[model samples]
Target: MHTPEHILIINVTRIGDTLAATPAINALHEHWPQARISVVGSPHHIEILQNLPGVVRVGALTKNSALFRGWLGAKHFDLAVVYNYDQALVRYALRVARHVVAFRQKSPAINRRLYRCVDPDAYPTVHITEHALKLPVALGIRGANGRILYRCTPDEVDRAKDRLVGRNFDGKRPLIGLQIDSFPTKSYRDWPVESFLALCRRMLARWPQAGFLIYGGPAEMPRTQWLKQQLGDSACLFAGLLSLRETAAQMALTDLYIGVDTGPTHLMSSFDIPIIGLYHPRHPARSLGPKDHPLNFSLDHPHDAAPSSEPQSMSDITVDRVFCQVEKALATRGIS
Candidate 1:
């Protein structure tokens, strides 16, 4: 058969896409048990892949540098798969590998011409977890599960709980983790803060015994602060309070997660937690949605208003709509 001794999977996209690529790594490991599998990722994305199975090493790619490319050439990988089409990056991959595979559409042709193109859109319209499995499928490697995989150590889980347990959360109560922010660049994907506040009000009234833990990065702290002011006693703010790994651990303890189309949302889907996804029309819920976890809920408005030039709303999905999803999640747990 068709197998390489050394394989390199390149995905320099955001953290969600980086994590989504793990299934492909697992597929390669299953296909060629002896081949060494390494991945090229950024420092931020590398944290998501750390301690993951089926990965021998993850090389960090410095911004606009030849360092990563130089290593690729030196290592001389037998096969390469480029998940996103970065022309400059593809040139580097082409130089180092005997065979190269890349996504066909929405990619730069100038860079794409250097390698074999695979069309991921031709596959079924499903969750990103399923979409990522196309990488190995296009390579004639098959029979891999579409479920997203994220593994956290037992110590990691305990450390996160210890840090945030007593202050505002009772570990015994079923917690609802809310991520109120998306990336600064993809503001369109973010749900309205007022919508979040309204949902918290309804949930607090409904689940008297339940607690809410809101999380976001440093950049989102101001918004989270504003939200806390709006929500007087309903929720506790943990924005900028924990590291990414800690946030992942906190998610593991959640009974439900409600967030925008963000990396943390994707990260939460890897665990057994139930998710209520807030999606924008521009980023359709069909392909970029969450996978088949225990319970996954998505609210999308495809024909709604368009995204503004900068950080503005994209969809017209209302607070009432999101509250309905919250009710569904609560109902799943037989809270009401």
Candidate 2:
């Protein structure tokens, strides 16, 4: 196969899904060092792709925007790899690129048009990162690393530090970031608020100067506000105040991150900070936890051993189990 000058990678999904595709993107860059890699992702979460190594351009493309793309434009791309099964995106890639690689779509005709149509089910992998890597692997491109990539500008980093200083978190030891809930649709993944309160109480007891950075969207305000009220002066609420990019910048400053299996958790994994991610039974740590992270202490629900048709509660994971991992993470950093 000839080396391509320009490559377009499309993943119009949520933050976690978008981040899952980073390793694949990295593989493509490593294989063809001179390729100008352009990414199209979800509008709300596309900022996460900004400043990633080897990716020259990042943009948002929704199903609506994909409708009009490639109609008047020349076929400028040498190759395009799409992670989405959306026919519109694949068709757009087909129109604009000489060769296109994507998962087999529902339409046999569309699959025939792809330069390489990968069957997702054929490669049954335990982890989503590996599953996403299969797309690049189909082109004989091996992954450079398992870790997800993210970069915050120096200005953004400084602003985050300034915000922390304004909140008097300058000298606070172990500035822990908390992602209290998943999205509304996946509320079952959320650990009980009571559990978080218990964990915070334990953390405060251990490190009196420990501060909490509460992160969430507006939809999770009630839970985040309650946590803030419980933690009092020790917690700073950034739930509804900061933009996604701003949140990522602030996340880079944290000493530790303890969250559910959500987008921010995936984003936090990109950093070198210690993280304790709680997973539900359905989405076990093996499938969604941080990969190749030295400080990852992810816990899975007890019900993971016994899958049932009934909905499982995340509360099955006791506060004690999580605090034990917390102690281990802090001890590794010589904070204890």
Candidate 3:
């Protein structure tokens, strides 16, 4: 086994998958403490993982970005770990690294050359965090903790604090964070907006002083606006207003989170806060759930429905089933 002096991790997936790769990155750092590590991923998510331990730098990857043809290519990394199947990224790794690791690819067999290989498709039942750590484990790097991870710089956390301080929330009252809408592409994962409004109403009835932070992106402004209007003065909108890191930093201050199975929830999973990830049949909690977290108070499709089968409606989740869990998570944290 070669001890790498410089390592490259190509994880060009979105926020959730990028956060899922943290355990593998952590393991790589533990085993090769002296190796300088660089991670290249989606432009939106790279900033979230930039300040992590052992990460020398974070770069955004794209084909026309003059990427591998530039300074990144100049660095001859001793090892490269490819986490996504994007052929462009794989080709870039092959050009700049001496040893490459990745999942097995189909015919025309570029993945056959990998020094270490694990088929992610082979482990359908395993958590994504476990699946990611498999790349490092296949290289004989053992005992890697497959927990989900994230970062919030001190300044970022203070920014969150400032937002809260302005609200003048009672310190004892719970501060909740909500991500009402999922990414447009995964809109099927979203629960009914009425269900969310009902859940908030129930929480408010219990703790009138309780505040909420509603989160989403520009694409979700309409929905966010509607929710802000419903929650009124007690709720604040975070969608399209903060950077990805800043959103996470602000989210870190929440006492609890209730959101669809989306990227920002990955940020919630990082903090020691309570998470209630609402999942529909199209996306079961088993496959893409919150990484087996201790605070994972997730609810799958209410009925025992087949995940592979397309559902006629994604609104099957009931407000009662959700409110009960929110109450339960709060009670455990002594917020009741």
lDDT of 1 by residue, 104-153 (tens): 64656543553457666643355676677777887787888665677788
- Worst lDDT run of 10 residues, candidate 3, spans 64-73
Best TM-score among the predictions, by candidate number: 2
> lDDT (CA) for every model shown?
0.74, 0.90, 0.82
Q: How many steric overlaps does candidate 2 have? A: 0
Q: Against the true structure, whose lDDT is highest?
A: 2
What TM-score, to 2 decimals, does candidate 3 have?
0.93
The backbone clash count of each candidate, in order, is 0, 0, 0
CA displacement after TM-score superposition, residue 115 of candidate 3 (Å): 1.4
Candidate 1 lDDT trough over 10 residues, lowest sum: 304-313
Off by over 4 Å in 1: 71-76, 104-115, 119-131, 232-234, 302-315
TM-score of each: 0.84, 0.97, 0.93
Query: Which whole-number lDDT from 0 to 100 does residue 230 have in model 3?
Result: 91
lDDT of 2 by residue, 1-336 (tens): 479999999999989989999988888988989999999988998988988778999999998899898988689899999997899999999999999999989999999988999988532245888888888889987745778888889999999999999999877888899998999899999999999999999999999999999999999999999999999999999998998889989999888899998999999999898999999887888888999898998898988878788989999899999999999988877888
Where does candidate 3 stray beyond 4 Å?
66-75, 107-109, 122-124, 169-172, 304-312
